[model samples]
Target chain A: MTHIIFDLLHILDEAGIDQPVAGNVISERLGISRTAVWKYVNLLREVGYVIDASAKTGYTLRKRTWLLLPYEVKRYLKTKVIGQEMHHFEQVPSTNALARQMMHEVGDEVQPGTVLIAEQQTGGLGRMNRVWMSPEGGIWATIVVMPKLHVDQIFLITMAASISLARAIRHEFELSALIQWPNDVFIGDKKVAGTTLELAADEDIIKYCLVGIGVDVNVSVEKVMPNLSRLVTSLSDELGHDVDRAQLFSVFLKEFERRYQMMLKGESEPLFREWRSLSRTLHRRVRVRTIRESFEGEALDVDERGALIIHKDNGEIERVIAGDCYLI
Target chain B: MTHIIFDLLHILDEAGIDQPVAGNVISERLGISRTAVWKYVNLLREVGYVIDASAKTGYTLRKRTWLLLPYEVKRYLKTKVIGQEMHHFEQVPSTNALARQMMHEVGDEVQPGTVLIAEQQTGGLGRMNRVWMSPEGGIWATIVVMPKLHVDQIFLITMAASISLARAIRHEFELSALIQWPNDVFIGDKKVAGTTLELAADEDIIKYCLVGIGVDVNVSVEKVMPNLSRLVTSLSDELGHDVDRAQLFSVFLKEFERRYQMMLKGESEPLFREWRSLSRTLHRRVRVRTIRESFEGEALDVDERGALIIHKDNGEIERVIAGDCYLI
Candidate 1:
């Protein structure tokens, strides 16, 4: 179903926006019935897409009110495969939910760089079971990667993704970005973006990993959850101008591809070094929450396995492989 | 659908060997069609069952099969929830495949102790992208565990399961079972069983963990894959007798529940101790295989994080959090 939608989008892209093109032309181009093309056009309109139609003319792309469509985002994309196969939804409970479903159905057959993107998520999730507010214009995407790496080394992929987002922010808008341990891409003391890494992994091997990332690209701080409103900021809010989300998404996928290739080749040392250089949590006073207990400490460094090393105030050093780290 | 099967099984159990008199009465009592009852009976017979059915009479159990049916296995069961909700398939690509599907559809509403069992798996999986053989009489079951623990501690659940299997084999058959590091359950230095832990988790929190366990019970060594035939042994082969698989499964689920409760309460130290005690890899010469490289060392101990600590020949110690460990 998503493939058919993409096919229609491709036909529309080829038809161009000069004038309304007939359904027969789209049908012939996509190798589908005219009725099927008309159905898809209606679906696009229902999802906030405005298409101008006339008896003599075909369909004109008047306005694209929907966000994160592959046709719109793929224009600036420059990568081998990432984001090449995208599943876009107007309103989904979560992109990760759909990505997980697709990953199970296809398993390792889901090519690396395949992405699941959604405009708005009703049940958007953050790491540690927290809810992420994914309003319209916010980027909710999960990329499927088959690194064929060990389960522990999988964390390196997450670090690479964080670095990609940080680098993209710096290069595109000249905004200084900081990375919180594990997955968040932050700006100064406030969070501008967050990421969650979910895996369909066994003990020794990872079948596939879903790197679900949510960025406050064009979301207003006021529109975010009230509890998180004070702690979070958006790229649009920080830049004092609304950024083009499609362009931002393209930059992220490209950066992600470069880092992901390095990771697959086991060249994560440079990526980790770059990550450390941009990381703000290390060497800062912080508190770490594990299921067993919570501890206050000064963050030291992240080990090769991506475990956070913390030097506690009580003179004890703790290696935290998994937990929530909050900067004090 | 599974709940209905269990209810019907309970009614059949109560009907006993009194054939016509009890079977007809029970079928009518349950308000189900008599042909539907007979169909369930025929279904059981097709799967290696040896029930005595007469046209003028009803069904009588002449002999119990070694199949892992809920009715047959749950007779001696003792667990709060681990195997309470059962799903049995005659042939599936993988039990993990079915469990992953159920996890999505059921979400958090999935009952704890839910078991997905399959008789034959065409595409059974092992750790690190290996294939697991699931022929008839071998146990292919995945138990859904919802533990309110940090994602890092999730490995402890796997460790505890290995310990439980080891203890169950030792107590039930008086066999000296040894646990290989991470997953494989062994007997006399040969692989007798194996386990794979799949998680729907992020860095800090675990949504659920599906512990897919495959034990070569009551299976002939000649039936196994040629490459693995020599390296593996079954409980039947080890004991030199056809062990009752239903009884063994009941004992394992009972033991698993006890250990799982301890893990959920953050009491993994005792479970870890038991794992070390039962482990054959500890203090033994072994080789650990990771994606980067393979290293030879003497297994020292498993840390609190369930990572294997290996002391190299050069006196350097390596902490392997996730990998394939083989006895050398």
Candidate 2:
């Protein structure tokens, strides 16, 4: 059910686009009594929406705050599926964790492009159970998607997400952000944002992918975890002012869809080329630590299927599917 | 809480083992009243356990039918974690699907070696969401584990499972079972059993693994699906009588742990050599189909990581990680 308040608010937006809308006009359109319409106007006033009422003009929406309301996000999103169905929560343990649980509960009913956004994640996960400091100022959200890809092609989703985030950063602030291979995005050596892509598969077939994004938008540098502030960079700290998270998120969704369509069409060449240009780990001396083994090698190239090819000192080129690549 | 019925039953077995002990002795041993002891004995008799209860003889276990009860499995289980904590259901949709949900519910509280077993799986999953026909008289189970290995080393779990299953078959019935790479256990040209390994992981760490195994124990060929009957075999069909499922499961759990420990110790040679000996896929003309592409190649050898090394027509040696392999 659409909240009556949202329905009334939407009418106010449509009417106040140019001129004031009369009470009788809204009452007729909504099929409610004039007394009920006036009562709703009073409710809107109580909810903090600035409204002007007169005997001649029914109501006028003077100003609206940029909270991450569904209408506010929908007004900006142009994507087909990504972030199409948004579930906003005030607080969650982790968006990705909640996404996984929801997927299990609904099973196939959980549609792709469904998004779960939170203002804060108390137990937000980093890779390998590491603590992710998801304060209220950061954009802590997870986008659920079902990608038609094989096991080897799973990494392509992560690639698309990273490319989308990088493009969004460039589009929004003209910031030259670098994408660290596999997932994290950085501003120079300091980290501004990161992406974690998780999926459920049956052997080679992928069931769903949960792409989690943590972008430090309006976070204060001094408020970050001790000893990590120097390594972490927030948009507000870099821009010398607060950055609108909803605007950045909207831009990201649009960019994400563009690159996602490219991947669906199997046009990986352009995606790979752009990712290579924005990567800081590529063509660098790095230590790749995998679960089974660790080796130091010169990072050569990432293959079509997203396998990082590294030339070892032992005259062997290793194709690493999943591992930690640390620049030495 | 221990079921009062089971508690009373355990006391009867103990008292009957040495001699036809009196009712007062059983009641004393159990710390229950003589009336409660007799009440439990009658309940056990109703449940199909033959107990000779008299004023002189407290209880005597005459026949214990072969059922995969938790206590029976625990009594036979020698391994540490594989089947230590079992979740048994009379009927379920899929053991793996249930296991995944349980893991999500418990989160980090989920311990390794937890097993989910079902007497029947109505919607058991085969790779790629294919319908796994799990009828009565089949072993439908999933073992949960947290493997500390790289993504590429994932196949090692499947390998150990196959090798352990093959060893168990040979040990129990003295029959030969061949392991087809990636996962299926074959007898001659027909498949007798198969395994499905599913996991939740990022680019680096594995959160958990659910290894689903379906063994055709006492299932009649005619009772199986029409198209699959000809290509599938059963233990009863091969052995000329119904085999004990609890023993087979017990043996499989032990063997799986043995092979699992070997892999953890970095002993891949014994595993590889044994897997090669039992593999019908080695050095065979096969067709490999992956998500990205598919092609015909001669199966040359399997590497330490358990990836099938195929020699293509153009002399390209390709490593096949996950795909359906067909004999040409």
What interface Cα RMSD is found for model 2?
A: 27.1
Quote the positional error of residue B54 for candidate 1 in Å: 4.2
State how far residue B213 of model 2 sits from its true place (Å): 1.5
lDDT of each: 0.79, 0.78
Q: What is the lDDT of candidate 2?
A: 0.78
Off by over 4 Å in 1: A1-328, B1-12, B15-23, B32-40, B54-58
Can you write out model 2's per-residue Cα lDDT over A1-328, one digit (the tens) per residue? 1246577778988876446788778778888655455545644553345777665666788866435555567777888888887776556689898778666534454557887788788899876667888987788888988877887787777888888888888889888888877788888777888888888998888888899999888888677665788788888888888876778899999888888888888888888998899888888998999889999989988998788999997889999888788888
Counted clashes in each candidate structure: 7, 0
Q: Using Cα atoms with residue i matched to residue i, what is each candidate's TM-score against the true structure?
A: 0.48, 0.47
Clash pairs for candidate 1: A20-A58, A21-A58, A21-A59, A22-A58, A82-A113, B81-B113, B82-B113
Pairs of residues at least 3 apart in sequence or in different chains that clash in candidate 2: none
Model 2, runs deviating above 4 Å: A1-328, B1-6, B15-23, B38-48, B52-56, B291-294, B313-315
Q: Which lDDT tens digits does candidate 1 get at residues A263-317?
A: 8888988988998999989999999999899999999999998999999999999
Q: Model 1 clash tally?
A: 7
DockQ of every predicted complex? 0.01, 0.01
Q: Write the per-residue lDDT of candidate 1 for residues B59-78, one digit (tens) a residue.
A: 56655656777777879998
